[model samples]
Target: MKNLVILGAGTAGTMMANHLVSKLPKKDWKIHIVDQFKTHYYQPGFLFLPFDIYTEEQVKKVGKKFIPKGVNYIQQRIEKIDAENNLVDLENGTLSYDILIIATGSKIAPDEVEGMMSEEWKKSIFDFYTYEGALALRNKLRDWQGGKLVVHITEMPIKCPVAPLEFAFLADSYFKKKKIRDKVEITYVTPLSGAFTKEFCSKSLGYLLEEKNIKLVTDFAIERVDFENNKIIDYIDKEVGYDLLVTVPTNMGDEVIERSCLGDDLNFVPTHPNTLQSLENENIFVIGDATNVPASKAGSVAHFQAETLTDNILLYIDNKPLKEEFDGHANCFIETGNNKALLIDFNYKQEPVTGTFPFSGIGPLKLLKESIFNHWGKLAFRWIYWNMLLKGISIPFVSRNMSLKGKNINN
Candidate 1:
């Protein structure tokens, strides 16, 4: 039997497994997925955890529940990949594969930032990227009582780039509802030149940040955390004092990539921008946060890639030309709180513009504009994620490629 080995059974791998299992013949193809963890996390939900929007129970589920039964699920830590020999070494044994898929998702390592892992990590400084960090921050927030709360991003290319902004907005609302808005002072620290990476999106979001009275420290490169003095010092010697620090630390791809010597400086696999194939090996495919593509590391990007990869993998098996159709399509809902949110859809060639989404001239969702209906759609996504998205079912009026139907190209 031919081997099809998949690394990391997270969002991208799980979705690919579900999408490919029915397509590939079980008798001929022995599908094997490897990951150390048994529990899968709804990573997007991590954004809401600090604000008490999602509980611990809601964010986690057994990996086996999402993984298809026919596929062999190997719970093992990968040592490295010998791509030249087409073999992967794990803690237990070596697994050989005819085709390999790298879906090992990214992680936030606070240790990457100087002084972040020392002294006051979970006490004064906390991160919501992990379950433990989220719970810790939740407890801290519960008794905060009001002070200088700084929500900071250590670096860029973090999963869900919009999450930090969402957190800032939500915190503003949360404090207001708790009648402590005046008592609390919130500041947003980012490495980016604006609130968001994209210029247009940044323009809109930056204005919102100002309106909410959440201060923005842009273009500030973090040098270290001065936990001893209760401040964060930037490379330029500027410091921001804080009573509570909520941070999104440096995010990198799984350690397996680092061990395998198949990744870039940050352990992200070097992938063909348009093809979704690994630059080091054609037989290996990478998706989601694992790839060093200049695209948003969001679930929507992974879903779009899975469909194109499905076709490309089949083509590889049939000795046909690979279809290079993935256009960096990414869509995300930015929660602005108070029963309002904004949606943005764009690809490599296009930036987010004020328009409707999924349809031209008529949409149930508007892009880059706040509306209660958009908020409902954002909440409804959790259900859609589990049912339609994870199951490889298509979303209505949505396609993998960015459509120009409702987009204001002239603007």
Candidate 2:
């Protein structure tokens, strides 16, 4: 039987396995998925963890529960990939494959920033990217009486760019609910020149930051965390002191990519923008946060890519031309707290614009504007993610390719 090996059973790899296994003839192909961890985290849930919106039970599940019966699930740590030999080296043994998919996701390296790993890490400074970190931050925020709370992003191209901003907004709400809004001060620091990377969305979200009284310090490149002084020092020596620091540290692809010698300087797999196939190796493919695709490393991107990628994988097996079409489509809801949120939709060529989503004139969801419906959409997504997304079932009103039908192009 022809073997197809998939690495990392995160959102991308999990969905890919489900898509391909259902379509490929079971008599001819054998699918094997490998990952070190057994628990599957609804990673997006991590964003809400710090705010007490989701508990540990809501987000954690067994990876084996999601894998279809026809697929082989191997729990092993990947040591490296011998891409040249079409083999994956595990801690225990090496597995060979005819075709390989790299869906190994990205990770945050707090140590990449000096002083970030110091004693004050989970106490005065914290990260919400991981479950443990998020839970720690939640506890830290609970007893935080009052002080300058800085929400900083050390670098860009990080997973879920909007998450830091959401944290800032949520922190504001959390403080107000605790009767400490007047006692605490909130500031958002980023390397980017605006609240968001996209121009139109930046304008909208920047206004939100201003409206919420969250001070914005743009274009500040963080150099180190001065835990002794409770300050974050930037490259230009600009300093922001804080009693509590919530940071989005430098994010990079998995270490196995570096060991495998298949990734770029940032350890991200080089991928063609339209095709979703690994540029370095023809027999290999990459999806999700693992690929440098210039798309948001969000679940929505993976959901869209899985559809197109599944078709291309089939084409490759049949000696047919790959359907070179992934438009970098991504949609995400920005939680602004107070039972309100904003939705944005865009592709590689277009920035987010103001309008309705899915349907131009008749959308239950509006883009680039904060509304209660959008908040419900954000909350309802958790259900969809667990039931439909991970199950490889496609949702209506969304497509594999980005659609400009409902978006206002003029901005």
Candidate 3:
């Protein structure tokens, strides 16, 4: 019998398990999935957790519940990857595989920045990227009087790149609802030149900061956190004081990748941009935040990649040429708060432009424009994520490849 192993049972890994379970011959092969935790989190909800938008129960569910019946769900710590021997060392045992899928996703490495993991962490300084951090921040914001609320991003390639912006927007709405809007000074700090890297998006979405009265600090590469002084010092000696600091720290892949010597400087595995195959080994496939694929590290991106990867894995098993099909497609909803959101659909070749989506000029969902309908779509996605996305059920009309037919592309 042949063995197929998946390293992480997160979004990408779970989707692949569901996609391949029926396709692969059950009599000839066994499938196994490895993850340390028993609970699966809807990571996007982390952005809402701090503002009391979602309750704790809504964000997490049993990990084993979503895993397919035929697949082996091993809930244990992964010690290291023996890539040379095609073996994964777990806490209690080791598994060998004929084909390996690395879905071990990225995580916040706050210690990467000096003073970031200091004593004040989760007190004065907090992060919304993790469940613990979000809950802690939620508690902190519950009864606290308002002051300077700085939402900052440490570097690029972070998961859900637009999330910090969403947090800032939501905080504005949250404070307003609490009747403390006048007391809170919201500042958005980023190393990027603008809220968005794409010129079109930057130009189009620039009004959000001004409209919300949120301060924007651009190109400030932080040197360290001055927790004692309640400020962050940037490289050029620029300092931004904060009464409360909510930051997205340096994002890197799991340490097991570093232990296995299979990842780059950031511990992200080198991967073929189109095929989703690890550049180091064709037998090893990568998806989601694990691969250095230049795609946004968002669940929607993982959902799109899953469809393409399922087909490629079958091709790999058949000894056929794999298709270079994944085009960095990502569809996301930007929550602008106040019961409004903006939708964006793009691939490697296209930046987001204003138009209709899922249809040519007839979309009920508008791209690059804020609307209550879009906000509903964003909220509705939580249901879609649990019932459909993880089960490898295809979403209606939203193909894996991004369509330019509906977009108002200027180039």
Candidate 4:
């Protein structure tokens, strides 16, 4: 039987396994999935963990539970990816594949920046990108008296690019609810010139920063963290002081990509934007955060790409031309604090526009506007992710590609 191997049992890899198990002929092929960790984290919940919005049990599950019954699940660390010979080296053994899927995702690299991971890490400074980081920050926020709370982003191309902004918004609500709003000062520092990389999105969401009374320090590229004095120094010697620093450090792909020599400077694999295939190898496919695609490295983008990639994988077995179908479609919900959120739907070409989703004029969920309904929708997504999304059950009415039928482009 032909062997099909998948790397990482995270969001992207899990979804691809579910998508292909039923599509690929069982008589001719066998599937194997590898991952080092046993837990499957609901990554979106990491944002809410620091604020006590989601309990510990709500964000994680046993990784083995998500793998389909027919697939082989291996829980082991990957030593390297020998892409040259189409082999994957695991800690225990080697895997040869007729087809390989790389869904190994990106991670926060605190070491990339000087002093970011020094003596102050998880003490006065923390990150919510990892479970340990989120839980530690939660404990820190539990009984600590309020002071300057600096939410900073070291660089761009981080996972869930809107996450740092959401944390700032939620911190506003959290402090207010705790009756410590007057005691806390919230500052959002970013390397980018505005709230977001996209021009339209930056303009649309810019007012919220001022509305929340959070200080916005733009275009400040950090050079190092002064853990001794509790201040971050920028390249030009500009300084931002903070009592409690919650920073998103530079994000890079899995180190295996670096050892494989298949990735760019940031350790992201060079991938075709639309096809989701590796630029160097025709038999290998890449999806989600691992690829150097210019799309937002969010879970919804992976779900959309999984559909297109499954088809391409089947075509490759039959010696057919792969479809250039993925369009960088991404749908994200931005929490704006106060039990409200804003949703944005866009592709590589389409900018986020104000409209109703899944319907032209009758959407029950509004886009680009803060509402309690959107907040509920955002919270309800956690359920959808566990039950429907990972199981390969398609979301009702939401197409894989972006549709401009209902979106008001003129706005």
lDDT, candidate 3, equals 0.94
Off-target runs (Cα >4 Å) in candidate 4 are: none
In model 3, which regions exceed 4 Å deviation?
none
* Model 1 misplaced stretches (Cα beyond 4 Å): none
Error of 4 at 304 (Å): 0.3
Q: In model 2, where is the ten-residue run with the lowest total lDDT?
A: 199-208
TM-score, model 2 to reference: 0.99
Lowest-lDDT window of 10 residues in candidate 1?
202-211
Tens digit of lDDT per residue, candidate 1, span 112-166?
A: 9899998898999998888888888888888889999999999878899988888
Give residue 133's error in model 1 in angstroms.
1.1
Better of 1 and 3 by lDDT: 3
lDDT of each: 0.90, 0.91, 0.94, 0.94
Evaluated at residue 226, the lDDT of candidate 3 is 94
RMSD to truth, every model: 1.1, 0.8, 0.8, 0.8
Clashing pairs in model 1, backbone N/Cα/C closer than 3 A: none
TM-score of each: 0.98, 0.99, 0.99, 0.99
Clashing pairs in 3: none
Which tens-of-lDDT digit does each residue in 1-411 have in candidate 4? 999999999999999999999998999999999999999999999999999999999999998999999999999999998888989999999999989999999999999999999999999999999999999999999987899999999998999999999999999999999999889999999999988767888888889988989999999999999999999999999999999999999999999999989999999999999888899998889999999999999999999999999989999999999999999999999999999999899999888989998788988878888999899999999999999889888899898999887799998
